[model samples]
Target chain A: MLIRRPPDLLPSEITPEPLARGRRALLKGLGAGAALAGLGLPQISQAGSLGTLRPSPLSSDEKLTPLKSVTGYNNFYEFGTDKEDPARHAPGRLKTQPWTVTVEGEIKRPRTFSIDDLLKLAPLEERIYRMRCVEGWSMVIPWVGFPLAELIRQVEPNGQARFVEFVTLADPQQMPGVRSPLLDWPYVEGLRLDEAQHPLTLLAVGLYGEVLPAQNGAPIRLVVPWKYGFKSAKSIVRIRFVREQPRSTWMKAGPSEYGFYSNVNPAVDHPRWSQATERRIGEFIKRKTLPFNGYADQVAGLYSGMDLRRFF
Target chain B: MTFQPTPRQLTAIKAALFLLTLLPALHYAHGLWSDSLGANPIEALTRGMGIWTLNFLFLTLCVSPLRKLSGWHWLLRLRRMLGLTAFAYGCLHLLTYLWLDQFWDVDAIARDIWKRPFITVGATAFLLMLPLALTSSHAAIRSLGGKRWQSLHRAVYAVAILGVVHYLWLVKRVALLDPIIYALVLAILLGWRVVERIRLNGPWPTRSTPPAVQPVVFMKRDAAAALGVPKKR
Candidate 1:
């Protein structure tokens, strides 16, 4: 079977060399002002906004999944379960503008904020992270947002707060799948307060430099790097700081299958599927799944004494 | 009287059905060529094979029920072909999981089959299909003789039930739509058979042939009750 590989757009956005991985500040063609100012519109018109990200040390040396494949193949149950369903249903149906996130509960400044207002609340930066889905496929995504910790700090949690719950939008008019009880409708996810405040936990607003495509969770979404992709709730509408663990949608949907922590542990496989290895998008072969999605070095301390297998 | 195709026509129809069985693989090939298998082609491929395997299983199970329902006894001629196609798809699904998925990690494969309930049932269903496929030939059928061949093939109903259970448990949350449909089908197919037995006599396979149709030698006397006809010794 003779097939032609597309010419590499290398020495461009994605560099192969590990040393040049995080040199995204120099590579970003759009100024920060342009990206910030264009947040009001559904589309970001800036040329480089959808191009090479301003990489950081957190970016991986591994290959980057194509933006087309990344956005096209998604598992947003709000749209549908098929990988192509979200790409087909979300773009035209989802209304991203006029979106507001309610940041209430256990916070001193409990108030609703728009996409632009969230920008004002915190600065945006690019961090490339490997997103491993519990389905056993992984992708390295260049995400644009600030640390979720920054927003948590800004909100100022009360001392009694021990967990943070994130709720996704449940509008059947836009998200057709919300009409079905495939999952508990208002898809909820949560993190331990410390996990929410971790430097790696990002409140992503954009991806590949542009504002997030609706299917990719436009406006704002949680991007917890260490957990399975579902734990990184999308199109987040509310953030609740509570004293105890909240009922996360997946955990509630299948308690034994999807645990509360849902961390990326290669050793503990899902009852139906294995977690030992994952097929990276665009590649034929799978690589060994890293513990904590390769951030175990930084995040392992959070679960020091607890048994992951039982919790998982 | 029921309209029946001639032997020549039946052979042609069987050939067509054989080609129809390969349509799913052809559709997958087109998807692979056009790059439409989404971000995860292997996942799509694995899933496609698995779905098709079950699909053929249901089609095979439906043969007897449909024959009984519609009085289309000719449908039985295609049962072996349908069953074999299902077995072939099951092999592909397993091979894809082992080679493309586990990359021949024998230990992981063993652990998966042992640990995963869904995989255990699915593997059992697949393993059961192997003997049925091997004995599908006329030579094996003759060597085993009619009664034992019929007895061995009777296990297909059990295999079909296990296949549905495998699919039902394989999903993350046991989403009922698809699995329930499969279960309902297996239920109806199996239901008709039990009801059929009571109508024939008691729950035992007796040596009986109705005096009403002594010359109806090719009517599969044992299966006649399931064929919606009463037979007596």
Candidate 2:
């Protein structure tokens, strides 16, 4: 199962790591200039154009998965169930233009922000996060977005807002898979108010220095680094601040298999499969899955004194 | 419309069918070598092999119904080859899981077989195919006698059912359409056989007496003669 690495170019021809980093910095500066220039103009097409992203120190130094695999392989059932279905069907089928995300319910200032307005809410940062799927596969993706906390601050949720629920777009005309009754439609995911405000939890607008592809939940999506990939709802249209714990789509579909709190703990085996180890996409050997997907130091406190197995 | 081929032509057809069955294996090998099996090549290979095994099983089951409906007796001559191809793919699927997935970890493999319902069902299906594969030979068939051999090979129905259930249980509940289609095809194939049986013998098997007519037995002899094989005299 080992794939041979392509023959390396001559050492003299290769750019050093620091120089490459400097070049990326230069590019970011130029991108910022371009972004400012395009501010007055109408919104750019969703395929490309994410403007500028301020690089974050929080990004993982581990090798990023190839953009091909990141964009190609997806589990957005709104497109279809097959891994490749999203990539194949989502591009043309999904219309992200003139999109507006309504943030309401248990919030003081209920606002419906256009995609453009949402992008400008906070400074976007590049966070290289380890995304682990429940189906024994993992990927390290350089996601470009701002923290979810930024939006929460803007809306100012009331004390009754104990939980946050994310609802994604489900249009049958746009999403063909919506025609099939696969789980409850308009995929829903929720997080505790504290978990939503965590620095690591992001509302991703793009990846790999480009606008988020339609398959990867174009325009905007939630990115919960410590949880299983499904926790991150895609193509979001509504964000609700609720009091009771919201039941996620997977949780509703299979209560025993998928729990509301799907934190990536290697010890917690899925009812149908083991999660102790995960195949890291391109690599042949399975790597040991870490507690909280190696973000235990940052997120372990959120679940302290709670039985993860029971919650899961 | 029926046409009988010469023994040489039949051999050529059999050879062609054998090569056709190898295409799926070759496609996967090419996918592996070219590094085009998406993100997880091992999973792609494993699942592909398992699917082909089910496909061949479906083909094997279709033979009798096809021969009966179309009056093409020679189709039965290809059934054993189809069954064996299904078995071959089943073996490869198991090997992929053992070597690539489990890394030959006996402890993990044993635990999986014992704990996971899908894995247990899949393993049982493969194990049951072993006896049918062993007794597929002409000599083994002669030693066991036609009635006993047929009864033993009837285990294929069970194997097919288990294989479908294994697949259904393996996938996420949302992705049940593919496995359900396999289940439907199997049901129709088995249902055809049941209807044929009812037509041959009354709906109820009253122990009063056996039916005077045995067209199925005669058809097998006719198929053997068509394929230029000596009858069981």
Best by lDDT: 2
Q: Tell me the deviation in Å of residue A51 in model 1.
A: 9.7
Clashing pairs in 1: A24-A54, A24-A55, A49-A209
Using Cα atoms, each model's DockQ against the true complex is 0.48, 0.59
DockQ of 1: 0.48
- For model 2, how big is the CA root-mean-square deviation? 7.0
Q: Which tens-of-lDDT digit does each residue in A31-57 have in candidate 1?
A: 753454345332333323533233466
How much TM-score does chain B earn in each model? 0.83, 0.88
Which residue segments of model 2 deviate by more than 4 Å? A1-46, B205-233
Question: Deviation in angstroms for A97 in model 1?
Answer: 1.9
Stretches off by above 4 angstroms in model 1 are: A1-54, B202-233
Find the candidate with the highest TM-score and give its number.
Answer: 2
Candidate 2 chain A: worst-modelled 10 consecutive residues by lDDT: A1-10
Cα lDDT for residue A254, candidate 1: 83
- Assess the local accuracy of residue A186 in candidate 2 as a C-alpha lDDT between 0 and 100: 81
